[model samples]
Target: MQLFAYLESFPILHIFELLELTLAIMIKRLLFEEAEITAREFKIVAITGPRQSGKTTLCKHVFKNKHYVSFEDLDILEEADSSPRSFINKYKDGAVFDEIQRVPGLFNYLQTHVDKVGKNNQYVISGSNNFLLQQNISQSLAGRAAYIELLPLSLLELQEHWGNTKNPVFFMMNGFYPSIIAKQSSAERWLPNYLKTYIERDVRMIRNIENLNLFSKFVKLAAARSGQILNVNNLANETGVDNKTISAWISVLESSYIVYRLQPYYNSFNKRVIKSPKLYFYDVGLLCNILGLNSERAIKQSNMYGAIFENLVISEIKKNRFNKSQYGEMYFLRDSTGNEVDLVLEKDGNLIPVEIKSSAKYRSSDLKNLKWFQRLYRIKGGMLINQSTENQELEDGIMNIGWAEVANV
Candidate 1:
């Protein structure tokens, strides 16, 4: 039951060596380029993502000259709430407003200041709750604000230490959170506390759920269903809650960036194609903890290993896509008769199919759905992602790429 003790059994990562390798992450993020461009062009640039994904750090790094004020401080939040105009005037030169969603009414004041000044890069805002942040932005600063989504570290972002050779399972268990990867922090020690805080603070802020214990149960149950088609009715039954409550809780999780729903790609490919979206956690290490897979051996022996592996590959690819400012372009293909491709990426006028498998042994049969889908669509190239270290080209245009190289694809 002791999560930290169980995690300590994994292969030790030398702290000194890891610090040397992870220096690149501390120095730069893939989103820095996009954030910089947005800040230059837009009067207000908003960086939003799950908490501790490094929004504050990235904002400070990108806008070093700007004064930073956190609204998480109760006194500061009260001041902004009571005297929005004066608060805005106090930071008239410009400031990074961290956790801006806490003072929703302050956005109108921000709008006024930015308009009168008529200068770009005058204000930068960030928050963890996407729904509240975007709602405030749409109501007040729609055209003036440009948004950037920052997920956990992508595989490509951490390529210096973990790109080609490390086992995908290791990263899956350790996770890709900035502190965990950049500081060699213990996932076991950190994630439990993070989850508790999210349930206590974010869930309360988003919506009033009378029972925190029930909500916690719903989240763990949801984690168990990761990488599978979401069946709300069944989940509601299992959680002893109505479908409507289950649906609302899911929205809270999605808005807070705890989990994401990967929609099913539908086309003329089949009329009976499954339309429900599949669920996935934004960070695999958190998913592992929720499922009580504290040790590496437990992770490998558990039946969910394959699903966890699939989640890692898909989430990394998503981070890569979002880092480039692309949104709503990823999906999975599954039909009534057991035809499924792990991931389907919609590119510029083309559908790039990707298959994920956890086994290292190359099985010709594992490529069945990928091959079938490509031929049916008359697509020329595809990728078979697996646990292999050596990237190789197979018959046709499909390539077997290691999981660590997922973000690159």
Candidate 2:
């Protein structure tokens, strides 16, 4: 297949390219280490989320005491692929298997080992591609696996290491992918190369993309459409590919952690549930690059301000979800009608509904959906997050908070 067709050619490399895999990953230490404790409690820790979202880094970071073996290391994968049990036995007491999806059969063997040992965090298993990884894990590990989402650096984690800045707008404009935060000499070349390399490696790894050009076009089109309700047919028409391929390509981007789909949330007494999902890029800077967004001035003047704000909102929710140290447990809410809240935090079935707005000025109308949905679902309460200067209690029973405040809390 001509799947490699989509990888744009570039003749340069950044210094960070050589250093990314072993740069001492400052954010790893700053990230929620206490969060990994939950996975340790489970029989097998299944770390997932988008590519370069740092799944491998987190595994390496947490399993400092455990021997490390990467399937991408060729020899290790050959061992696991040829002799799953023996491959595992070599690790003996235990080890970290990075990108275990490359050797799916080993999971069952690992599960057996954990069962025999009777639990105590026997294995630290992580995969960048979740769609197939989850399927194999469910088939092999199931209840034995504890899955955690390792997304791109969260705003809160960034602030911790990078230090807090006065510019909320700047952060919102660039967003949080670790490489961008590294302050490399040339994010210009770095960003595009990163996207291209990711497209070639992770995107092609999932499915054989015969029409790489179409796939590349799909990325550009998707970037331009960020923050809008995703229309598969429209995307299909634009890309000259079937909706199935478009959908699959989008899934590839999502699985690679390049973009995320924000499923809408709401229930006007079962009146306004939207079926179509809204898509957002994992990082604003990447989206901006694909869409040709060059300057902070340009992002500010662009019409996507509201959508970018909403993207920031969801990204923060994802960060905190991981921040809590819980594994594989974050989702949005919506029904059949159009009444919608931006995000939903569903834990233990409590249904914490959240809303996000870009304007510092928040109004009662902003939280109407949340209030209505909360009353109907009997949720804990509706949380209204925005660019407000300070966290305050609104008279109308809503919690008005700055985006940053809500992210850490």
Candidate that would win on lDDT: 1
What TM-score does each of the candidates earn? 0.92, 0.81
lDDT of each: 0.87, 0.72
Worst 10 residues of 2 by lDDT: 6-15
List model 1 lDDT by residue over 1-409, tens digit each: 6855754665554443334334544547888889888888999999999998878778777787999899989999999999999999999999999999999989999999999999898999999999999999999999999999988777776764553446777876788887787655698888888999999999999999989999999999999999999999999999999999999999999999999999998877479899999999999999999998988998999999999999988988888888876644888988888999989988887888899999986789988999888877888788899988789988788889977677677
Model 2, position 124: C-alpha lDDT score:
76
Runs of candidate 2 with Cα error greater than 4 angstroms are 1-36, 266-268, 325-340, 344-355, 362-384
Give residue 406's lDDT in candidate 1 (0 to 100): 78
Give the per-residue Cα lDDT of candidate 1 at 75: 98
Error of 1 at 83 (Å): 0.6
User: How many Å off is the CA of 171 in candidate 1?
Assistant: 1.4
